[model samples]
Target: MALQPLPILPIEVLRQAALSRLRAGVAAANAPDADPSALKTLYIPRHRFEKLGPERAPLLHVVAKTDGGEGLSHELPLVASVGTLHINILLASGRAGAVDLDVKAAQLTQAVCLLLLEDQTFLEQFAYVEALRVSMEDGIARGDGGEFDVVLVQIELVMAEGQTQFEPRLPPNDFAQVDMTTDIGPVVGSDPPQDHTVRLRFEPEE
Candidate 1:
């Protein structure tokens, strides 16, 4: 049989795929609200998150790094890679005319989880999603500025394809013949031992 090419999903591709879908979802939610304080931006930070300022508030940070694989076994060619994608929802606690930071965090977290669940296209990019979890806490943002309420959402992908390296092709099974022998018990006094032997040809099955 002809060998087939291996399947692979580069890490960058997975990260970007998730970022695009999330950005789209946030945009869709923001448009209808039409409120100046409504969440506006979702992005993958190019610099250290601590260096970012308050202007980046009402933002979502998508982090997709760190993963381990179900290593290949039994001479299998490939295996799945699994990991978590973290979405950090940040909002300024004291922004004027805005809802309570706690309320905003809950709303944002709900929207994020719903979008990821309802949007089937997102899952098409990977093998499958294992589960999603969310938590909230206070965090310092942008130098010594006021604390921002943060919501963390973790999405665990059970198995993603194309992330593992493929094993080299196995050599063909080729053997020509087999030989066998059996030892028999000796008689009470005279015979030391008895033996039986046989040989057979081996042919590859069609």
Candidate 2:
């Protein structure tokens, strides 16, 4: 019997996986100790990102901006997602400088890219996306706050997501069937050349 392939993930799952991984990467993240707890994850509602309250000097925000693709295609569910990850670098005194931010952002990018290349991450599926990529978009100043440098990471995710099935294990077969063959009737061109028949029967050990 032929089995159906697993269903592909919905658009939300694909987009959300991208966002979640990025956020999780920065949450209590361990890297470049000079910026400890400085490289934290940020999440604001799409409609209110611009209205975020007083955020710390150094913070990273990950957002899934758009989900656009053939919901169901290629006999499987596929999604094209675009996301944004912003790294806020503190430019004020007694805090991290542009160099520090650059180092952290580079480190963060490497970590997230490794995640994207994975087939299933921590029980979530984004399966090896051949078309996955991250773009560094233009950064701007946060006019509402003190000296802050904005670093944006434009995330593009494209992959067919599916679940994993663990099949049952079967016991080994130790019995081998024995077959017996017999010929009925004389050989061809023999006396009268009677009809010939070869019969095969399987018999188990008594």
Candidate 3:
């Protein structure tokens, strides 16, 4: 027996795909031929991320948020899903630099969005996408002894409907033996009350 397949649109898988594309995009954008951009990308929970120090500034974090779906038709095993993704870009404002942290955040945010929307491989993850919206918010992330400028990018995706199938788990040895017996009464005009016995045996299919 083979293991069951996972959901066609798993949130974790999508999150990883987003991260891969972003990392590649960022690396390409900051290639040796171009001006280097200092940044780190992560896919982790908020609590764990809070433990990081200011040295990890100029970072990009990808987080998968809410997800929901609906059946395309009552008669079919099809579903239409929507997912929310967030990218938090942080830049250390405390660092002494000529460039403004706010401006840097904005630039980084643009790069993230552009990569997500333009990447064909990322877009192919959805079957039939109806719509996609990307929005951003500027704020500050206060830490134990410092604060960093943050650009929060939110992406809402309305994916196309797809067929869903369920598979049952089978035991290691799923063989069974079946036997059945039936009692039949004598014909209507039979001499006396008499019964006949019929036995049947079932076998597994080859």
Per lDDT, the best of the predicted structures is 3
Top candidate by TM-score: 1
Return the TM-score for candidate 2, rounded to 2 decimals: 0.43
lDDT (0-100) at residue 143 of candidate 2? 48
Alpha-carbon lDDT of model 3: 0.61
| Residue lDDT tens for model 2, 1-206 | 53332233244454555555655555536545535443344342333245543333333344344333434345444444322223232221222443555555566556556654552663354433435565664344644555455555544555444443334464565557656666676777878677676767654554
lDDT of 3 by residue, 101-155 (tens): 5576666666666777788888787666666666667666676557655555555
lDDT of each: 0.58, 0.46, 0.61
Model 1 CA deviation exceeding 4 Å by range: 1-11, 30-51, 95-99, 140-206
Give the TM-score of each candidate. 0.59, 0.43, 0.58
CA lDDT of 174 in candidate 3? Answer: 58
**Higher lDDT: candidate 1 or 2?**
1
